[model samples]
Target: MSFFSRRKLSEQELNNYQQQLNEFKYKITKFEDRLDKLQNDLECKSQGEPLQGVNVINAEEAANRVEKAAQKALPHELKEAFDEINSAVENEQQSVRLFQYELGAYVCANGKPQRKRIYHIDALSKKLKKYGYETKLDSNGPNSFLEVSWKGKETSDISKIDPAKKYVLPLEDTECEITDSATGKAISYEVAYACPRDDKWRIIYDRKICSDAVIVPGKEIIDVPKWVRSIEPIEVDY
Candidate 1:
């Protein structure tokens, strides 16, 4: 072919290009069809129509499923602690309860004044230590308590926690930033712990973020309780 002249494509080359173009067009059409179906399904859902080929669940059933999922996600020790706390609160008896605060964990005894009993501080400390946590027993003070914190440097990163395999039991009103697995965006959530008053722990993400986004804790220690305050009566109500 001359420098300024275009060379004629061979029949084989033309057929190959046409095949490729047809493939591209086919893919685009399929993609558009999928988009249309998704939009139509969403509209039908908004209009309270049953989605075709989809298993629709009632509100109560959906709520039950979510509750079950949340229960499955909770840590075993945390669940046990919550049950014990609930029982103690219900019976209005003296018992030691574990509270997971933003900075650390606190084990506090609830009930009438007991000058002699240490409230199973040693046993609780050992239990916490088994989970790679360092426990400090504070019995010398007026109110005997135990503080639990991450044991080593490796425990500082909350992102290392696998949500599918494990869950962190943070106290109510605790705040943390998490990364959305779907959008790869950072989202902040105010955590509420589950107790007798509340059946499930909840993460209320910021209004600006999509509530449906799957999120995991950001790279920071979320379990460590940084400050200590005067121990007061444990209120399970509300």
Candidate 2:
């Protein structure tokens, strides 16, 4: 004799299976929504329009916008000499960081020659012209910088310098002592150098006591010999 029997799923089992199916459906819906958005973005790009609810700008357009903003920010007297400006903008985010142009000039104060930064746009413009040079905005990889040209020939570039790579010397010739919160040991360290790799201060101490070097945060390092925090950093060959 042959016999066959079928067992039905319990209520709990049925509910679990239903929930899994609903989760799968939800995931499919999300994927479809994403695909639709990508298609719309492609269409907008093909039509030379920005994506909806997203900021986008080309390099040339960004440069013009930055120039306009700089012009407005400049004093009225400097407006005429403001020929062009260079800057970088994140294409997708439309974020910009413009370089603040400076004219390295020297001034005499109290019979001492002191270096002065001339940020006046007009003065910079006039100086550039007097030197038979002109500046144009140019792209350098993903960023932008001013390309200096003399008589229509490219001479040099003015680009943003990494702050951590800048050379610095302590205002006072002394070592700083601080208790290491991590090791609970008193340590003496001197500002050895600025590490360009991670944009942090490299502190050096006796290798016998601690590691050869340790990286310190800017906030902590700035407390020692405060003058190292100058905007116009002193340049030295590492």
Candidate 3:
């Protein structure tokens, strides 16, 4: 290769290495911040001083926003089906439980069978941070999953809001069913949907287990590749 060509290649390689190093540094900084926050929470808890509660918006309000977004995004034909899913979501939100033990606030939401949804707390953390409230997820204890505080004050007082009564839907009944085109075998699937801050719908089909099942999106489930034969929304307690 010519001298100029070799030099150009070397420069490109160096630039790539530098970019990787910068990314590594960014990850390390984030890790350090999480570690420091956890340490601060532990120190405050150890001192036996009263730990402040982390403020969270009403679960009902958060769930309502999600329902409205879903209703708007989904097609008119899906109104009845979507309503069923939305009702289950609202029931779960209304039945959310919060605890003030273990030096932090613990938020809990029961999921289908073995699964327990914790995304709400993560969303709560981001919302609190937007309002200048420093928040950290506390998964240290099985019960508690969030620790909220100010930037300087590790024990700031936060109004504790009780989660609505714990609501859970049985898994024996399936919400939706799909047949694998490849195998022609039909399976019951659990439909889990979420609308994040980005205002986009994230949907998943799982079979009670963590493994994701086959799903093809189209105007109608039957129109998709893996034809969805039938859909039955789980009976949710209002």
Top of the candidates by lDDT: 1
Write down the worst ten-residue block by lDDT for model 3: 221-230
Ranking by lDDT: 1, 2, 3
Residue pairs in collision within model 3: 94-164, 95-164, 95-165
Go through the candidates in order and give each one's C-alpha lDDT.
0.38, 0.35, 0.33
lDDT of 2 at 128: 36
List the pairs of residues colliding in candidate 1. 103-224, 103-225, 104-224, 104-225
Candidate 3 lDDT, tens digit per residue, 110-148?
211122222334444444344343456665444655444
Show where candidate 2 strays beyond 4 Å: 1-5, 51-238
Separately for all candidates shown, the number of backbone clashes (residues 3 or more apart, or on different chains) is: 4, 0, 3
Residue 144 error, candidate 2, Å: 50
Q: How far is each candidate from the true structure, as Cα RMSD in Å?
A: 26.3, 27.2, 23.2
C-alpha-based local distance difference test score of model 1 = 0.38
Lowest lDDT 10-mer window, candidate 2? Answer: 85-94
